[model samples]
Target: MTTALTQQLVDLPVIEVLYSDLDNTLLGPEGSLLTGPDGRPSARAAVALVDAAVGGLTVVPVSGRAMPQLRNDARLLGLSDAIGEVGAVILRDGRTQYEWGECPGGIARNPHDTLTATGAVDAVLDAFPGELRPYEPWHRGREGGHLFHGVADVDAANDALAAAGCGWACLRDNGRTGGWEGRSVRAYHLLPRGVGKAPAVADDLAARGLRPEQAAAIGDSVEDLTMAPQVGAFFMVANGHDAPGTIRTPGGMGEGFADAVLALLAHRAGATRDNRQAPAPAEGTVVPSTVLVVEDDEMVADVIRISLTAEGYDVAHVTNTAAALSTIQASPPDLVLLDIMLPEVEGWEVLTQVRSQPHTAHIPVVIMTARTMPADEVRGYNLGASAFMRKPFTPDELLAQVDGVLQDTPRA
Candidate 1:
């Protein structure tokens, strides 16, 4: 589809936001565009990001695509400068901005040699009938690449290839499923080994005059882990609970990415506002409750804290994961009222951490957040949470859920 190219965004300050990887990260399973219930591209977050960039945040998408396809996607998104092929090609405002790491005199110079080798590789893939399905020829650099998604026995496939004089490796781990389930695979035959997504993002950020600490990276795969830790902040999509260095979001894919971005922006915005405003809780309370209030929003945290205290339960309030963990260590509460969105650390990570610890693992955690998706609730249950509740819930309903969980026998 046609996407509007952004005109000069001169209104906001230029803050750089760098993203690594496209598929399963920035681009959902469908593509870069996310579909809403009505089946149209959900541009709310994308528009928000664009507005944020125009307002002073610089947004850059760094991926492993070849120049041609990368350029196509950029045109579609109206992205000006993007780092492609993991920094092999850098496009600034729709032009080749800079070239570093296997570019200039490197990979791009040997596309022909790479293509020949890729043809040989394809021969091996073609040898196995009904075993591997090649989606299409993805030509970039010297090696031809193909994306596949299907069910196959790793051991059997390896053995078959070995028997057929062809060698193959599975780059995807447990995260490979769905269209690519047993069949989903990513194979590269060009450039050089050890050329991953992180270094590309890092180099591009440096070129853009941004520090890793000044930027945020959000992803949901082994590929993303390569760059997540290096950035100032790293976030994992909620579906990537098993993936390392990723903090779960209230929503999945586009929504999760949006949540992560907002969390950082909100934190930054709050820091600026804090200097001018007197430091105080949104609503101060001294009530007590056996229920622990674990919300990042100060107002919500205070309201719950005061309301629970007034209800005659010993109340403990903590605003962040570090403090909340410390509080739980000192004294385990009867229940945990958790918000899915939190600063620095996410609510799901906190819940996972709480459940992992023997001292507090059995305590029922009731998720309280604006994330009210069915998949999100199912994921919470799968993660061992007792019950999930959305935000703006009545104190009475909150109390009832808390009572029910506290009264029930702890799961072994």
Candidate 2:
């Protein structure tokens, strides 16, 4: 059943700036950008986000993701600012600020290092035993908190930290996932005692010189609800647990987040007469972003297609520059993943033509090549390549490249 809009929410003042969570709120399951809550191709969230951007709303992603990761995401989503690492890292005004909320461990250097030196992470892990482990692969890059994947008794973990003489530390419940241990588990970040989403948000509000009435936040977890007091109000996606001052929006996942966005748009100055102007696709709608992969290798093309498809992007593959150009002329893609080594004509030729053309000059192009020569990168960049990605890149690296280029282009 749909939850009718509350008069209380409708009566609130216009929301000029919106702070939204990333993983399971602005995005769908497992951070799939194009997928809807029903696990189908949908641009509901992306459309709403773009509308908010075009309609003059300052949208900032607030999440527990790493700073660099969030920056890439912010760019891909056509946003400029974000609150990452559960508010531990704040990216504002072209700089990253680490807001280490008063830790007993002196702030002589990196806060994450100071927290690590206290051994609180180890203590939490040891206390939970097999139930806890560092969230693998990406966890090593975190500077905000020691991200862990487990079924953690948060209070018990805090007790362990305090017992270990690290009374200035605590555990934050990020969210739930089934990516490990063959069972659903929660994501936890061991952070400083006083540092959390709320305090971080309050600090950002002060920096922006905006009153609480001008701001609103939306998120899917209990950690997200903490931002309520810092903003004029907080809207929880239908998937999130309820809290005292939270209002649950309709739909689920990305669509639900978009609904909340639509609600705010109703009160904005440049908002449309009907805030639901960009609704979800009915049955066979196109994905929001389309990426064309131009690679000669079938294995490479397949890998690229699969990776992009999994991320909820529409992908078209062409093994040669001839087919690639044909596809481009037939239907212009949002971005091009071009390969340097192509049949008959080199990929550089395609890049040059694409850059010089009037109709397609604005489309961002990413050059992929195994050529390690310095001149190759220089030539690619000179030819207007948005990004020159070295060959043999992991899927993560490829996505990062795509994201970085799109961040600079209006097509994003």
Candidate 3:
């Protein structure tokens, strides 16, 4: 049934937030989602938070782990929306939503055995005997993929696996997947050739009546790196493992995850209001410091709202840039959170118009987006943005960047 909270969210715009990496990115090192838990997420709290965001926008947890195992956790966590196996499998509302790259013909014979699911893994292990370790299934009645605990030569192992039956291959980053009777550990996400998180989440969104721009993907590993660039925002939680161009979080485990979620929620909150009067003259800006956050994703918009509200900023969040532009001309906000993908007019065109206008040109615009390419960043900055930041950032960080810019304005 639609709860009161859900009803409230239904009225607001939505932004989807896709979190990758259960070990640390979503939970903690130990897979706990609670605050006091050593590893991070305790599972129960994770479900509650997700439940709260359901009607507004979907909260999808994407992981590289096997589907069944993650499914079990999903059941335990009550994650109505989840994607597993680096996006090869998907489950929503506790039901198997979709499975891709698993050829029906190849699996038609086995039916019961998921062995066909581990073709790429088997091939990689066969080519490099000593480098790969195979682990038994984590559950019964299931023939799962073999885990490679420690490999002396990753490059050699990958080359060998390439020649094998063909599937996805990922270097292990977490040591949880026990291989070789629990000898060593590393990060990995090997899967079928066509399988990946972007496709999986994208498919999930399509099924749910959402789009890529309506969602945000968060991760801290190579697998996520492959998917992050495609979403509205690719948040890289700073949990030690580093990637170039990634927005680093201040803390580790739950702190980093919470920080990112909070930032996204702030965006959502900022965009919820229908009529946002700019900040009072005393607050600065002749037209009032109103904001228009243009985001179609509910989860993202909610997070953005939380952040913007916390800063004592008033905002009007909208979905389409075209509608946002019309509103701007009618009543402009002091700032705009423009996403590149939008109906009718793209975010770039919106930015061009914002800069070209005589009245709106001087308004401060912060490009809060997930476009990570250097060219994108350069383009955002070149377009006269006060600040440009990729998605999945912490609210404090986003606020800091915005506050720094607004502080430069002469207070009215």
Candidate 4:
């Protein structure tokens, strides 16, 4: 009930994956994925998803909902994996990667059924009268955990369930739900002892060969906050109030999710300014071409990727000049977007090397930079730069330059 913000963070790991809680975290009002918190239809959430995908980051939605609900949500969200049933079931690439349960007596039984059979669900329900009730309609067809929604002293009820010969199952406060008693109430889950979002996330990270520093999680519940320890960064939506030791976002629901995603992407893009959507690509056949982006700044590289990838260009990025030259020699892309200020070597020298090489000489180079000296332009042209672009160019300019250069190049 108290809003206590987490202390701010100074340094963060380059996040490779994002674990998000659904239902009021990623999805906005009334479970509408595209709606903003202000109750108007908006595509900010959808665009954020595309930004993460184009930026080459994995997005996994974690929820207490069952497999069926998660399946539908994944289909609509253009995702292939989801963690459902509060971590009891995990589906990746359309197959069950990890499914947790307490199968007793050599029979496969779900936690919800076991809890019901052991009268644990009833014990918790009886302990809290009008304050707790079965979350019906949506609660049916669940295979991992049963849902309950209401306000109750969860600790006292969990103690009562343990004393009633149903210690195997306990109540988990799943954060806020719709109204009960004319005010907001929290959703609860009755799952087996070990099935929880945090453990499953930790185990999933290990299976992916990822360190705790490589992943981040965002959600709007205390249960979701448990993931803070397992991830490189953990963020809470403003609507979730506050918990200590977590980063708080400015927005709530889908808006919060979008903001957090962009922040993470910016960090990965070497801390470029947060990106916004580029102009939609023209409706026409797109020529598939691979464009190598040579920029140390992560955010700008990400924006370029979004713009080009939208037009069906395969984007490859390298943070330094060495990787750029190496990739060009190994497998020359159709075009190279080079930045003048690099870590070790300058972009003009790279262009000179490309021109001198017999095999890579044909590849087009576009010098993109913030420097606007007349001498720099002369140097770029002398080094055989095909096109020189200034920094802070619009998406239209980027698309036109690439399209024009690619069209001029001969293809066998």
On TM-score, the leading prediction is 4
Ranking by TM-score: 4, 2, 3, 1
Q: What TM-score, to 2 decimals, does candidate 3 have? A: 0.54
Each candidate: what lDDT?
Answer: 0.56, 0.76, 0.59, 0.78
Estimate the overall C-alpha local distance difference test score of candidate 2. 0.76
Q: List the residue pairs that clash in candidate 2.
A: none
Give per-model TM-scores: 0.48, 0.60, 0.54, 0.62
Q: Best lDDT goes to which candidate?
A: 4
- Number of backbone collisions per candidate: 24, 0, 60, 3
Candidate 2 lDDT tens digits, 113-141: 87878787788988988998888765776
Candidate 4 residue pairs in backbone clash: 269-298, 269-299, 270-298
lDDT of 1 by residue, 289-333 (tens): 377888765434544544354445777777788888888878887
Model 3, runs deviating above 4 Å: 1-14, 35-55, 97-99, 102-125, 129-131, 137-146, 152-190, 274-412
Per-residue CA lDDT of model 3 for 237-275, tens digit only, reads 666468764556554565556545554454454454333
**Residue lDDT tens for model 4, 1-412:** 1112111322555578899999889999888998988889976678778768866679999988878888888889988889988897788767774444442323336555667777787898899887888887667878777788988887887798789876666688877778456878898887877778898898889888899988999999878888889998898988885787777877789988876777676565432222444445445524647999999866567667755775667999998878888998898888899998999887777788888998989888999987879999998888898988886565567878998777676753
